[model samples]
Target: MPKVDAETIVHSIAAETNTPEETVARIYADALDTYRADARVLDYVPLFAARKVRATLRQNSAKPH
Candidate 1:
């Protein structure tokens, strides 16, 4: 797999989810940290982190304000 760039991921996620880049960046960082903690294979960390952050943003949006 090609190397993933965090900035690209952050921008893509922010655009797709209609979220702010700053917010996405913060969440992506946290998600990356969480996944990195127990990841045995480092190659998929960015993919996993991006998925997790996207899911989290979606879930949060679904919740009642």
Candidate 2:
């Protein structure tokens, strides 16, 4: 499988979640780094990172502010 591009993932998730690309990019980068820190296999890092970003966005949006 080809390596996933971070920009592409960030853009797609941002659009799909109706979030700013900057926020998504930041969260995605953090999630990617966190996952990469202890990853044994890197193939699914992007997928997992995207999921974490989405879940985080959802949680944030759900919070009372």
Candidate 3:
């Protein structure tokens, strides 16, 4: 199987959370920005960012109005 990348993560989470792709992409970019600000390690940055975005989406989904 082909390896998954950040784009794939964003799309997957967007679909799973029933969010717009643009919104998910924006969120992913924001997550990357946060990591970059901290000078996070290079190799695992994408994975970490994806995990962060996924958690954010999950948390948002779980919140009640």
Task: Tell me, by TM-score, which candidate is best.
Answer: 1
lDDT values, one for every candidate: 0.96, 0.95, 0.83
Judged by lDDT, which candidate is best? 1
lDDT of 3 at 26: 96
Candidate 3 residue-wise lDDT at 8:
83
**How well is each residue in 5-39 modelled by candidate 1, as lDDT tens digits?**
99999999999999999999999999999999998
lDDT of 1 at 30: 95
lDDT of 2 by residue, 1-65 (tens): 89899999999989988999999999999999999999999999999999999999999989999
Question: Which ranking of candidates, highest lDDT first?
Answer: 1, 2, 3
Off by over 4 Å in 2: none
lDDT per residue for candidate 3 within 6-63, as digits (tens), equals 7788888888889999999999999888887887456666777888988998898899
Range of the 10 consecutive residues with the lowest summed lDDT in candidate 1: 31-40
Better of 1 and 3 by lDDT: 1
For every candidate, C-alpha RMSD to the true structure in Å: 0.7, 0.9, 2.6
Quick one: ranking by TM-score, best first? 1, 2, 3
Instruction: Give the TM-score of each candidate.
Output: 0.94, 0.92, 0.79
Off by over 4 Å in 3: 1-4
